[model samples]
Target: MALVHHDPQDGILITRIGQAEITVRPEPPASASGAPVILLRVDAPMLDTLAAAYLDPDEARRLAQALVHAAEAVRPATPWRSPRPNTR
Candidate 1:
């Protein structure tokens, strides 16, 4: 299994399901947002594909574990930092 991000601006969302890899995402909008409200909207075809790929119990477990690990690894190590350093 692999991690996936649905970035419409970027393009396709690529990820691995069990041993197979797949790409799925919504079409990019014509307009852009000033304050990006990133939202992932997965459709039926993508859901069906994912469901079918993980039909096997063992495969599903493996995928779940992989997803957990992937999420953990991506977590920020520290809080955000300001561009200008604090001055006395």
Candidate 2:
């Protein structure tokens, strides 16, 4: 599980994944609408691996889109519910 923390003092968002923790500062207001301002801090090794895995930008985008679709498909629609009794 990942932990997310919002700091009002610094206006920074911190996300802790496993043992790794990263802080991102949001961009100043007045940019494009609904654009993500914060940037995630990733180590060089991890960045290199990610780059190598998807050498082509187009392929990477395709893979990411596919992953999102697959993730949505596997997610449960709602909380587990027992089946209703069958009518005669």
Candidate 3:
């Protein structure tokens, strides 16, 4: 969970994934009031070939909306909560 790149101007934060390190960067909104975009990139060091997949703002929002609806549709009657931490 290390930060590989942080572009303040573009408002991009690229974080190192796991051992293989598939980068995940969330791009800032196209406009001030627009939704954010998500970018998944594979570096040459790991993949031997560079690749990238971008989820545009519109698509990202649509996916998120659908996910929320799906969750709501399949939600259980019992609400889920985190367990309390054990104090020594």
Worst 10 residues of 3 by lDDT: 16-25
Query: Which candidate leads in TM-score?
Result: 3
* Steric clashes per prediction: 0, 0, 0
Per-residue C-alpha lDDT of model 3 across residues 57-76, encoded as one tens digit per residue: 67767866897767766883
Clashing pairs in 2: none
How high is the lDDT of residue 40 in model 1?
31
| Model 2 RMSD in angstroms | 9.6
Tens digit of lDDT per residue, candidate 1, span 1-88?
A: 5666556677547666655556543333435743222223323454454332212345445665888767656773457533556687
lDDT leader: 3
Compared to the true structure, candidate 3 yields what TM-score? 0.38
Ranking by lDDT: 3, 2, 1
Clashes of 3: 0
lDDT of 2 by residue, 1-88 (tens): 3658887887666666655565555454345654434443533444343211212345546755887767766784567644758998
What's the TM-score of every candidate structure? 0.29, 0.32, 0.38
Report lDDT (CA) for all predictions: 0.49, 0.53, 0.69
